[model samples]
Target: MIQPQQQSFNQKIEVSNNFGIEVYVKREDVLHNEISGNKFRKLKYNLLEAQKLGFVKLLTFGGAYSNHIAAVAAAGKEFGFETIGVIRGDELVDKYLENPTLKKASENGMQFEFVTRTQYRDKNNATFLNQLEEKFGDFYLIPEGGTNDLAVKGCKEILTDNDKMFDFICCAVGTGGTISGIINSSYEHQKVLGFPALKGDFLFQDIQKYAENGQWNLVTDYHFGGYAKINDELKQFMKQFFKKYLITLDPVYTSKLFFGVINLISKGYFKPNSKILIIHTGGLQGLQSNIAEI
Candidate 1:
């Protein structure tokens, strides 16, 4: 359920003076809700799994600006579940945060529990969850970014209507769920490409394990500066991209992959006349605070 804006099928190639190759964007930023993007699909199967497991409470993790957290919180309120968001770090000055993602999560009636970065890493541990079950009672846990089988299943639904096959399908890889899901459902004629937003060191293995040997291509380059970091060049390109196409690309995830798509295309990567489909994982709500200006 990518927001209406993110799911929009408006498709075309926009040639920008800044980018050497012709780029066609899927217009996911406009898919649905202002907050739509990758978050909805990631949560879809997860919610179903929660229901199947007979779980009443859902606990997950994210940074203050995390799209997954916001999506889960909103989904919880809408679908009848107790949602707990383990926000990384203390709240500090909430007003200083430019991204309204966290605020929206609260409005969605999601409960929050802030933890140190160190503790957050071990949140999936038996001890942590045992304590949680003791206090909250029957609950299911979803990994950060909603990385799991349900996410892949939901993403598979993205392929039903589109008939075109692609030389390579690319997406901004955060936790490897979106790309892996696409690869799993991709027809033989298509190959999946992933741009790691963080270090790709163990990501290939992660995707393979998660997806169970689906057709995939790992194109590592466009992680401007790790997961949450942005740079001036990325901002310049984001602005230029929108100016040429009148489509918005927030500075966080999709923008990074959009940049990588161009970089790979120009460097003798994609075959000529090859159809390259990019999965815009949606996170516009998380982009309100990031730099996207030249």
Candidate 2:
């Protein structure tokens, strides 16, 4: 099993503007090299629990260029557990030639098993697990997006004991597990904010089901087009922001929502002098993979 490493606490909060919002960022971006960002926080306990449960092999689901798959493969190699990736679509045999994420996963020694788009759609169905067993034998299967109770447990630990209480906290919502964990970890006085990247079909309702107390808000306009989709404005903002602040934001998850937070603050939507904390879920490896296209 892969052992978890010590987390580093870096950077500090400062007043960058006169908007009265005390914006602070938790640098989850620098968690590790290959095992970077939110993936580490989400995967830490899952790996540990899998090991504790006597699981020798780890199985998880992801797409052709999934950050979760990349992290799982690297973590499995680092922890000595055999890793298998149940990839979406039956194009694995033809994808490695051009798919950067899959290429990196192979370099990390992860075995790939392809499933049809139809089969991958029903991840919770018994037939999927049966097919996995028939192909690669028994293994601990992690849900796609890494949103599990164990993942929530690990993410809640992101907030250390020394953090000052804030009136509100904000983060991007992908699988809703991290948001659920943040809501669980925060005090009653504080409110949790979720900016959703996936839209349509009552997304916040699902997130609310995971979070206790049902006190969360979604900044729905920031998703741009969809998951991993970006435009000129987002790319320009990312470049300029990095140039000015030396902090990087990936187009898929963190950057767009953070942009929304700042936009709202600038528009005077948030009350003056509000203390806000933004969680930086990391995906630079995936960003790097898209350098040419970006």
Candidate 3:
């Protein structure tokens, strides 16, 4: 892990005087430009473990615009390890250079193997993994979203003693890793709320696999249609939020999360005087395409 010179801090968000709740955002985004937020937490120990195991190369999986792919590529470049991204969509094989995320990863010295979406769906299959092994030789395999036991272990370190004052901890969920880690580290007095970026019932079960306790709940109302899907209202909300807070929220995750939490506050979802802390798991690099639209 490349420790930042300055650590993440909690910054309070000013909401309407009508609501009696206090909301603060943990600026995990400031940790590192590329390895910011939960990606840093998720990959910290995974990279160390890979190096400890004497692996010279690392392989992971993600889509063309996945934050995990970008982070892994940057990490590999900085740490002197070869990175391989088994990208989804064989159609992108020739045109991946057009994609900001993939282009950035490639520039960081990461190699890519484009596969069909169907093949990506079955990426965990033993046969396919064996084929990758035959092709790329030995490498440390980090899962799609960089979620694993080590990743969870790294995530557990996100919370500090200063966070104990909050009554509720909130974060955007993707593949269940970040929330699970937060759930494990949460104090008994705090409730963990996850705003999933994608709509799916499988998340609960996946979260259950790693969460050490049951104090977490998924807020399914704010996915904004589904993963990577955006709308005019959400775009406006994000724009207004940045204008008001001077903080940029990525359209894919943090924007929806902040929108949900604030909307819920307006609806009286949180108890009066409750303290809320929202985890800002950064993926601002993925916002490159949405910036022009916003």
Candidate 4:
């Protein structure tokens, strides 16, 4: 069984004093250069279980710039499994070089199957899965965004006894697996706040399926026009944030999480002397896709 490196918590200096609240970030991004952040946690046990089940190939779904896709490719290479990425957009097939995320995954030996967006939506349908099984021939399927019961089980290990001092736990929600695990492991008095990168209320229902506790809430106001969408304001914020704190946040997930946490602090949403812990769910590889634009 391949094990992910354990990470430690680091305090943000300037932001900690803002609004009289102390903020700390768990440096899950530094856990691994390729398979970093929540992706590593989500894939940790899934890979183990696949190996235990005597599976040699791993099949999963993701978008053009999905961090999960890149992480799975790297993990498969490291753990001796064949990887197949069912990409969302068919147009991306001929233009993989233009997208760094896809390029990296391809370089890591992951086979790609491009599908239309409408067809991709039926990824969980039985008929769709049956077709994939017939085509791929006996492979373990990991859902899009890597959210599953085993994934949530791995995520629960993110928080530990040392995290009990925090009043609130914050994380970026993609498929809700990471937050679900944090909510399950958090202290009773601690409130889990999820800043979603996508715009929609559907995540509430998705998360409710896995989270066992009622202490978590989704902050839906900071998506910045939805998934993989960004603007100059968000770009400038990330640039200055890195300059000040020396922490590079990806435009997809961690950026929105920090943006929401800071905005909530300025709005007096959190009480004074509150200790807030933010999960830095890394998607740094996605930064390469936006480097030219941002």
Q: Mind giving the per-residue lDDT tens digits that candidate 3 earns over 101-209?
A: 9999999999999999899888899999999999999999999999999999988988999999999999999888999999999999999999998888889999999
What tens digits encode model 4's per-residue C-alpha lDDT throughout 1-294?
667665656666557445678888888888888988888999989998998999999999988888889999999998999999999999988998788888888999999999999999999999998898899899999998899999999999899998899999999998899999999999889999999888899999999999998598999999998887899999999999999989999887888889899888888899898998999987798888773110
The clash count for each model shown is 16, 1, 0, 0
TM-scores, each model vs. reference: 0.87, 0.92, 0.97, 0.95
RMSD of each: 3.7, 2.6, 2.1, 2.2
Between 1 and 2, whose TM-score is larger?
2
- Which regions of candidate 3 fall more than 4 Å away from where they truly are? 291-294
Runs in model 4 lying further than 4 Å from the true structure: 16-19, 291-294
Residue-pair clash count for candidate 4: 0
Which of candidates 2 and 3 reaches a greater lDDT?
Answer: 3
Give the clash count for model 1. Answer: 16
Q: How far is 283's C-alpha from truth in model 1 (Å)? A: 0.4
Best by TM-score: 3
- Tell me the tens digit of each residue's lDDT in model 1 across 226-265: 7777888988998988887666776777788888887776
Residue 276 displacement in candidate 1 (angstroms): 1.2
Residue pairs with backbone atoms closer than 3 Å in model 2 (clashes): 2-79
What residue runs in model 1 are displaced by over 4 Å at the alpha carbon? 1-10, 16-23, 91-99, 161-163, 291-294
